[model samples]
Target chain A: MVHQYKLNGYHIVLDTCSGSVHAVDEVAYDIIGLYEEKTEEEITAQILEKYRGREDVTREEIRLCLADVAKLKQQGKLFTPDTYAPLANEFKERSGNVVKALCLHVAHTCNLNCAYCFASQGKYHGERALMSFETGKRALDFLIEHSGSRTNLEVDFFGGEPLMNWEVVKQLVLYARSVEKEHRKNFRFTLTTNGMLIDDDVIDFANREMSNVVLSLDGRKEVHDRLRVDYAGNGSFDRIVPKFQKLVAARGGKNYYMRGTFTHQNPDFTRDIDEMLRLGFTELSMEPVVCAPADPAALTQEDLTVVLKEYELLAQKMLDAKREGKEFTFYHYMIDLTKGPCIYKRISGCGSGTEYMAVTPWGDLYPCHQFVGEEKYKLGDIWNGISNHGAQEEFCACNAYTRKECEDCWAKLYCSGGCAANAYHAAGSVSGIYAAGCELFKKRMECAVMLQVADALPRQE
Target chain B: MKRIQTLETKNLCESAKKGGCGECQTSCQSACKTSCGIANQKCEKKDER
Candidate 1:
């Protein structure tokens, strides 16, 4: 089960038993290459020959190594904020600490109304009329002020289709540039758009000034139009895909990420993922939509089981392509890879309530993206800076990994702190949200891996 | 030498399957599969830790 290969003269040894991937020596593979001839059969023969009848490597060792290779080769690691801090630091040095603030819904207005959209369903309740230039200024001020320790700052424009106020976005970027000069901070930018309005101008601006451009494209035409569309009940997939194509072509397929959300309604998820891969995006992220407050949508046991099934199948396809040296990366899957192992020992988990913060266009701030305005999870306000109340203290105090109850939990470390939003929403308190969610996500992961391995195993049929 | 040094020094290479779900009957492996197996294993260990 353990595999060893040399790439660019590096000896990459995948030791499954040790559950470790060791580049034994950059030269070990070269030595193997020089000493042993290359060929699939020869390589396999050589490996068996070298290890076979070796009394030192015990059967237990062999078993451990096979498992190690299988586990490491298949799964990466879950990211925690602490682990991502160094990257944040590096990005700060290269770009800045406050690189990007993704304002998901800048304007409450939307042309198409999906059944689940907050703005469409909630009628933009208490939400600002639009991401006014003033509101954008306040948010920029907070970032620039806080970004003193950073070299460059990136501001990402987002929305319930930000194109609604594309003019405001354009103006804000210009305004932000001036603020950067006034405050003497380096500024970079990007935007997440629904390709409906990716005209030549937006494409031109995105390609020239933006470091990354992310577009939301739900898979296949029918599924996409059904969930993401104008209020008139028409499909936007055909309209958006053509624009998305031109945008990708304009950039020559570099410096961009495609994000999609899947719902239970779409059964052919593999097809959806395939179409996206075919679209030439090296980076992609697919999150199952946080369904409505319905019987099946509420992370029900059955719902989770089905989602877990689909996730494993998709992940296996991704893994196979990756093994064959594909350049594409699924963002969530890459999270584990980018995190590496040992992420559990350190405070390396999600960036919630720490490095990253989300600011609504109206100047309200939430610690992370997942729980934008769930009042209880609100960490601070942009107008007054981060809330000075015990919110920070409350957040720090609820470190579930340190708790005894969670100590024995199988997913404590990697689960880090589960979604603060979910904690409040599910348990009505953040008290053990991390532990609870950790356990939940663990079950999902286990199911995913189990299904995939079973499918790969020799079948009875 | 550097590769060996790095590998030897890193505990991430430790293959100790301490407190894993494979030992637990109700774990996800009982019912289904996951996208990231190693991650799930690590998470199981982390939770156990």
Candidate 2:
């Protein structure tokens, strides 16, 4: 249950079950590697040979390393038995249809054409359309009807730009509120927009009715402008920044996130975050771009080292901000290991097909928003409730438990296997691992752990 | 058996409330649980120590 990796010139070992992290020396690292498979005598022998020529090597040293291994075993940091199987079995046995959240593609056409747009400028590789009020209403009804005993239901108005279909979006919100009282459900609405179309009306409506809004802004004007261009091939930064500031000011800058994406072009992505902080944004999430590997802007193997370094720098900056009493939560740096792994997360992955499904503008249902444009992943439509139950079942069954690559992985517990869409995009299979994303996730986790440790260390007087 | 019982009895919402599950409020609890894979157990016995 212990996973080891080298970072910042130190070997960091994470015990998945107990959530214990240790920065161990090379001998300790080697011993941990052999503890599960080799006998102590064998481990000692191997260690002895590994350091035989070194002046620092000694039989006492090897014995001490073995003792340390035994201590870890006694403390339950190492040799923690696999408990995933029984839990996986129970999860599979108890898996049921409980649709709790729905992502409604309110508009399938966006004004701006981001270079890395997964939906290919928001058309999703299909005809540009807006969700008719009729379809949106049916989708809302479908969620309430299928939600079972879940009192808090969620619906995300997603799109090329949900703002494009402002009237339908508003009508749907009002309608959802009207139905909520009778259904004994609380509808939590969220709007994910490109911020180009934000106006006083949109801001006022969102503040009053929307649970939260996720506004996309890449970062500095130069960085954002390079990729996020409007119909006239002009940068959106100048247009969106003022609107974003206005919207944030209207909402008192709460219950909103200024979400950005980092790509190969910006390996030192911390600078972008610094710019966001300077712009007075409190809630921020800068995610790595998910695009084809062949895309020029895509983060490739060459960018990983710099990406890793930037994450470390960002972690340090976060620590400094906390010390200065100006703490802001970075989405990726947030990891709580105190509680054991979430059984639900391990078994289900990202609820793409099971508990949450995406409804296209045309009333077509897919497992998640990422699959809206892809025909192969279509589950059903609003008229027919989940015709492709098999697809849902497949998503339900997918987890680190089912993935062979994740079986022996220590990071598996933290990651719970990665995003299903990302996996599909990278490996052409839902169950496959996206190598780049996987590495980035691990690197982020490492940085998070380091940050946690740094934060715990007392400030020098 | 102990672990399974611990997991069953633990409150997923409580841990989520403590900011352990970052996007809990914004996400479907069932789906988030499935995705997190963190078995809902009594806050780790170690944390109590």
For residues A1-461, write the lDDT of model 2, one tens digit per residue: 77777655456677665456666667778878898899878987898888789765577777776777677668656566665555654553454676778889999999998999888899989999999999999999998888776677889888889999999999999999999999998888888889988999999999999877888988888999999998889999988988988898889645777888888888788888988888888777788887888998888787888887888788778878998998986766665545443444444465668777889998998988778777878898888888887777778776667678877777776666777787788778888878777777777788777665455433422
List the TM values for chain B, per candidate.
0.18, 0.26
Candidate 1 per-residue lDDT over residues A333-443, each given as its tens digit:
432322234432222223334434666667677655445556766777777766744664444444434345444444443444455545554565654453333544654
Local error of candidate 1 at A38, Å? 41
- Among these predicted structures, which one has the highest DockQ? 2
Query: Candidate 2 docking category?
Result: incorrect
RMSD of each: 12.1, 6.0
* Candidate 1 ranges beyond 4 A from true positions: A1-105, A118-124, A152-154, A179-188, A279-282, A292-300, A322-327, A335-354, A376-380, A398-406, A409-415, A434-461, B1-49
* Candidate 2 Cα outliers beyond 4 Å, as residue runs: A5-12, A21-77, A339-341, A459-461, B1-49
